[model samples]
Target: MASRPGAWRNILRRQPSSPRKTSTISHISLPLEIPVEEETLPYYEPEHYYPVHIGEVYESRYQITGKLGYGAYSTSWLCRDLQVLKVSTSLPKFPTATDREPKIYGHIAKINSTHPGQALIREFYDSFDLQGTDGRHRCLVMQPMHMSLLEMMGLNPRPFDLPLLKMTVTRLLIALDFLHAEAGVIHADLKTDNQKSTAPPPKQIDESRIIYKSRKFGRPDKAKGYGLPSLCDLGESRIGATQESNPFVQPHIYRAPEVMLDMPWGSAADIRNLAGLIWDLFEGEHLFGAVFDARGGHDPFKHFALIVALIGEPPSEFVKRSETTGQCFDTNGNWVAHEDEVIPTVSLDNLEKRLFGQEKQLFIQFMRSMLKWMPEERKTAGQLLEDPWLQ
Candidate 1:
């Protein structure tokens, strides 16, 4: 039972593209669908339906302000502390419950049941909830940021400046380090839509329009004249040492090679994803799309063709290792011995011959290392943090 290096291709056989027609389901009840034509478009649709606002207090403290974003099984919300009085003299009105110490039961009780560290988002003043729809919906409270990474990239298709890219990736890596190393969590759903930016830079700070600070504390504060990226959305995030089933991971474009191979994965898979995200920041486009769509459905031959164009063929030893792992392989007996082997003789010069030049080689090497089919072969976040590219 040798593992086939091309097993990935067999597992992702493509189907014909769907006809360009909208489904009949009403938009109000169903999830919002971003049409392919507007795929790169960036504008927040306020009317997007989120979870129901049941007018309930959570953990007898945080008050739900509004919906922030939605994930596979949970919805994110902007919340404020009911116990913390506003600077204004006006007293705050708290919600009343029918049951005595109603705070002891209902939504508030559900909130109190979860751990506090999980509740707070890294760096920012926010936290996440694990309970899904069956339990009281998890609410994440934090300072509001305006746009997502998707929106920012959509607005600026060009590669980000070195400073900005470093800052963004550094903050993202820090958050990921906390999730993986410190909190022992995996944000299965990491994407542009989840990384939000603080409110847009103010056109003018004060009536006088006097000189304002250009940079604050070595980081950009968009309110002053710089853009800061924030990571959000944790519904698909897993915590503790347990491996829970999750079907809400980001599409194939952001998925790591191990995830694509359906192999048992861990925090290293997240490091792979972060690597792809950094590539996206540099390339201003997804890398895996060269293979297939995120939702699946594409010609196998065509997908393989694209892969060949980018990464050449897999090495022979790679194939043998995959087959030994019982990974998905073409059952057809035509190439049985080769089934568990990969032919990695293709050279970088050959790859560059197909794409661009030196830069392309650097990018390909970096991506292929992170996208290795084996988790053990993949680079660690700490290793990537020291890459000369980041410096």
Candidate 2:
């Protein structure tokens, strides 16, 4: 029988009169009848969501208190046990990264380490499958986290102060070192969104669908101390020292030059990615610009031109190593572009306006150490921890 046109939108229940309070749930002062979460997306369907309701319990435990947030493939809810429940969309027979995510956590768990960064990596507490209308949905129980660094950055237009910047960079480097040297994993997608500060939640409702505002994650006063910064989202992570033949990795703007030229990339790619992120956090703007084409898509050639302008051309040996270097450069390892293609005129020194004298020079040196044309030339996460600038 055909399901009703919007049967899946049916709300199982309205708001829970009394939510269990293992943690606090601050309510946002938004409209009572806001739009349904995850309803407007083109790919969204009724069966894709696991049909959660406030006060509903799963696995004979873990009662849902409020909706946390929704992503492309999953919706997170704050639970009664100081846990966030991430229920993934139903999957096909074939396995995907979401399927492997729990196992990746297991791998990290197996590594016995006293590294301070170990605690900085988010880990799933438990995982189980829920039988949904279409297929089984994988649910991960995770510690409640505060706000993403990206969201945090949006709260303040000004760049992060030097103390905050130092703390952020040091913690990230330590976490990366732990993951690379101890866990032997590659966080291929290290960005502001993937790094979150640990914390604490609060939330609306209807019959056809539950209407609620996304809980606000406000920045706490710096006087209270910025919470421990932790890295999350291991679904895209890879478990190897050196990853080869992976054509696609990292966000477009943060993508390393080696990955752009179709060369082998390893943990060093993360160093480069972090360099870009650090720039974004400290400079209050992205370091690289004009990477998007007319259609608003990532233009690799334009990206290369920007890189060339800022960091100078890729070394000849580095150019020869790439499988598809011919697309932008000639056989002689010299850049070849159309008559209209314009290389940027600004250098790093010119673009960086926040610092002066020795401080600026040291900062640029720190960035260059990670943003090298050759992957081998980039410093490891541990080595970067010892950098005088960071100190």
Model 2 CA deviation exceeding 4 Å by range? 1-47, 194-212, 221-223
| Candidate 1 C-alpha lDDT tens digits along 88-108 | 011112111111111111112
Each model's lDDT: 0.43, 0.75
lDDT tens digits, residue span 1-391, model 2: 0112232122122332222324333444335544345665556776667667667777667898777777657788888887888878876644354676666677777666788778888756777777666776777778788888888887887889888898999999998999888988888888876422222212133342343335657778878754777888777788888777565788887899888777778899999999999999999888875699888878887888888888888878887887588777776667787553678798889989989989899999999999998888999999999999988
Worst 10 residues of 2 by lDDT: 1-10
Tell me the deviation in Å of residue 139 in model 2: 1.5
The alpha-carbon lDDT assigned to residue 264 of candidate 2 equals 74
TM-score of each: 0.53, 0.84
Cα lDDT of candidate 2 equals: 0.75
Best model number under TM-score: 2
Off by over 4 Å in 1: 1-67, 79-136, 195-223, 239-248, 290-309, 315-364
- Tell me, what's the RMSD of every candidate? 16.3, 8.5
